[model samples]
Target: MRRLLFWLLLFALPSTQAAEELRLTNGEWAPYLGAQLPHHGIASRIVAEAFALEGIEVRWEFHPWARSLLLAERGDRHGSAVWLSSPHRKETFFVSDPILDSTYYLFHRKDRPLHWESIEDLAGLRLGATTGYDYGEPFQRAEAQQSLQIRRLGSDLLGFRQLLAGRLDAFPMDKVVGFDLLHEQFSSAERARLSFHPRPLRSDSLHLLLSRRIPQNADYMLRFNAGLARLRESGKVSQYLLEAQRPLSLGR
Candidate 1:
């Protein structure tokens, strides 16, 4: 009777299983990525839910953008989200399909009233841009040739503030993000002073970058992409993007 009771008790106990976790790295780029925001931001939420469909949980490590890239390269983490695809990075990482569209544009004070039809149009102006970020080949080439006086900073938040202080005539950043940050870091009175140029400086798609050094990462990549496809087919991706536009869309 004791032996039978022992077996029955063991079989009746609930079974516990540990969830599979994917460690991903990234940096703060508001509305897209902010450690304090819900699901660590919109892009992060999308990536997490996509993987969740495959029974994978995401654990994000918020680091500086460059450091986030380094983490994936070193295989300290499985992958990094929200990076633009480049030939060199593609050679080293398993790049995912378009995670989101990134649109870069010039931002300046409303009082200054600056407009640039082309790269050459902004000649002689003091420009500000984020360090370690690629705006585009032409913009980079122009910077290399000293076409405009450029000031490099680590964050667009700082760059925008500097522009307000008259330290920089113009700064460049993502349109959606700029708007997102504007409401976050400034009040309506302060926001009235800044404006984004109608012409986009450059446009690119963001991707999830996975290191090739990890033997099993290839399979993980396939699962993530497949899950992402299901989300899109079910209209979840569209719904997410529309919701993301809420703070900016409703007010503006």
Candidate 2:
């Protein structure tokens, strides 16, 4: 009876299953990624929910943009979240399906009134670029060939400040990120001083980069893409993005 009761009690107890966790390196790029933002911002939220559908949890390690890439490349972490796809990156990592879209514009001070219909138009002007960022193929080629005068900076905020100070003629930045920074960091008067060219520098998709060093990541990539498709089909992705924009609008 005692042995039977022991087996019965074991069967009666609830089962505890440990969830699978994936660690990804991250950086602060607000409205998309920030350690303090709700769900760590929209992109992070989407990535997490997609993985959740596949019964995996995400653990994000916050670092500088360059360091984040380094950690992922070295396999110190599982991968990096929210990076633009590039040929170099493709060689080092397995790029996932598009997680978000980003449009780049050349931001300049309103007083300067910069005009550029093509990459060659602004050749002589001082341009500010963030370190470890991809501004697109045309811009990259121009910079490499010394056709454009480019200055590499540490962050987007610093690049914008350079533009306002007249040190930089223009800075390439994401349209949404540029405005968000202006709204968050500058006064109304300061905000009024900044503007972006109507023409976009480039439009690119953001993707999750899983490390090539991890053999299992190949499988993870397949699972992530499947889960993402389901999330999109359910219309939750658009709903969540629309909801995120509401707070930004209210703050502005």
Highest lDDT: give the candidate number: 2
Residue-level lDDT of model 2, residues 106-222, one tens digit each, is 888878898888999998999999997888989999999999999999888899888889999999988777777777887777777777788999998999999999989999989
Model 1: per-residue Cα lDDT over 40-61, one tens digit each: 9889988998899999999999
Q: Enumerate clash totals for all models, in the order shown.
A: 0, 0
Off by over 4 Å in 2: 1-8, 243-252
- Stretches off by above 4 angstroms in model 1 are 1-17, 246-252
Candidate 2 clash figure, as a count? 0
TM-score for all models, in order of appearance: 0.90, 0.89
The candidate 2 region of ten consecutive residues with least summed lDDT is: 243-252
Q: Which whole-number lDDT from 0 to 100 does residue 111 have in model 2?
A: 81
Candidate 1: pairs in clash: none
- The lDDT of each candidate is 0.86, 0.88
